[model samples]
Target: MIRKLFLIASLLAPLPAGAEPLANKLFAAEKSPSTQESMPIGTYAKGCAAGNVELPETGPTWQAMRLSRNRNFGQPTLVQFLEDLSVTATKIGWKGLYIGDMGQPRGGPMNSGHASHQIGLDADIWMLKPASLTLSRKEREKISSVAVRSADQRSVTKYYSPQHAALLKAAASDPRVDRIFVAAAVKIAMCKTAKASDTKWLQKIRPIYGHDTHFHVRLKCPAGASLCQTQKPSVSDLSKGGNGCDETLAYWVSDAYLNPPKPKPSKKPAKPRPPVKSARTYVLADLPSQCAAVLSSR
Candidate 1:
């Protein structure tokens, strides 16, 4: 019996060094194990599933699906959001407005599957344009000029239009917005417009370093996919002083306001030649004539 037990133990022993294990055999198994999984966005799932919408997939996925050329209207939720905003703007008497630069739809090189615009959920509404109105090139240029000229560097609140303020307020009130990146000046103007109750939404607008050209609206990624990678909302460090919005507004005024003072180029001095050492003196009696001749030759 002892001999039989020894034989069984030897058969079950680990393989020797440099030897391969059997392909289908298990050497050892753990009694307990741990696994990791990511949590899906429940809020997004609720909205998308109820709306009968699939999150827009652009780039390679679109190409693989062979629907590459379809005009992406944008994510259904985003379109709905825009519609709500547009209706509000119209009621308030804003005109000549249109969405701009939705970027490439899913499956284009420009989109690369991660573009905010490609998801059909993000749109750039031109602040300079009025709702349902079109502008000639010259007229558009004039509006740009007015935006620059009218902006005040000392006090942004003084120059911000009531129309612009209302638009921001409407966007902030939306529940789906993950965050909004606006010019510092615009953010400052928003703080003034925000009442105590509106502070919650006002806080969602994060002031980034360079948004003078346009505001960037980022939406929360819907559930069940890996694409949404936005960070959690935190109070903006830029808004700490209560003047960051004003500072940002002032900074966006125009070329006159935005441009920093040019630093003067520094001049370099001419390099000097290193000093030459004096020749060592040696008496003819202190060295052989041949050595002296060799040294002289060297």
Candidate 2:
């Protein structure tokens, strides 16, 4: 009994001096929220959240996927937006939304999966139209979202449907959303149906690599939210009031990007640079000062 007690005590001992712990590990260990007011602190990719709330694993209009990951937590604004969107899904012929990771309980950098979800304002919604919202937790783990993009990455497959487009439109139209990310092929398909006079909603849907089976939604900082930060150059300014269906979109699926030419031979090979430190490398000192408090709060 004494030997077992000594081993347990050693495991609980504090880190040695001059050692800094990874912020992701620190946040992931927090299974419950902090005892503080709800607030998303710092930038989306590099911050923490206080008083984050967890979405019920199963709801009438939505089911949070990957239950064992314990990442269904988000700010109150995000939770409401998701619930509202799920109801919208029913109107669009889908049973409900199958939500993915939202954030860690305290909302800091994660050890895996994402970097932006650290703020509790970002979420991944599966592209698969759920036939049933009553999926058992075990089944949710085994089931996978259907891929909408073709393997060539130049166009969407038969899996991309009108209902999926409608769902994307509704989410982007929401006032709470700042931007959404989808596969470039999906956006190209969306562009073809957009009317010249009414395509402003498409501006919020940005194209990035991957996301063939899911779309990522990011919310704007809530009103009166303290310590929250937004990216520069508003989406409208970047889009110039036009739907994002221009040369930029074309370039994403172009051969120059999808099938790039080989680099020319060089006289000397370039030296490898040290890895840049980011969310995955950030220590407590690298994040917002208040993040330390959030991580330590009971």
Kindly give the stretch of ten consecutive residues in candidate 2 with the minimal lDDT sum: 4-13
Give the poorly placed runs of model 2, Cα more than 4 Å off.
1-18, 234-239, 269-274
Candidate 1: list runs displaced more than 4 Å. Answer: 1-73, 107-118, 129-159, 224-226, 234-298
Error of 2 at 162 (Å): 0.7
Error of 2 at 125 (Å): 0.3
Error of 2 at 124 (Å): 0.4
Prediction 1 global C-alpha lDDT: 0.42
- How high is each candidate's TM-score? 0.48, 0.92
- Clash pairs of candidate 2? none
CA RMSD (A), model 2: 4.4
Question: What is the clash count for each candidate, in the order shown?
Answer: 19, 0
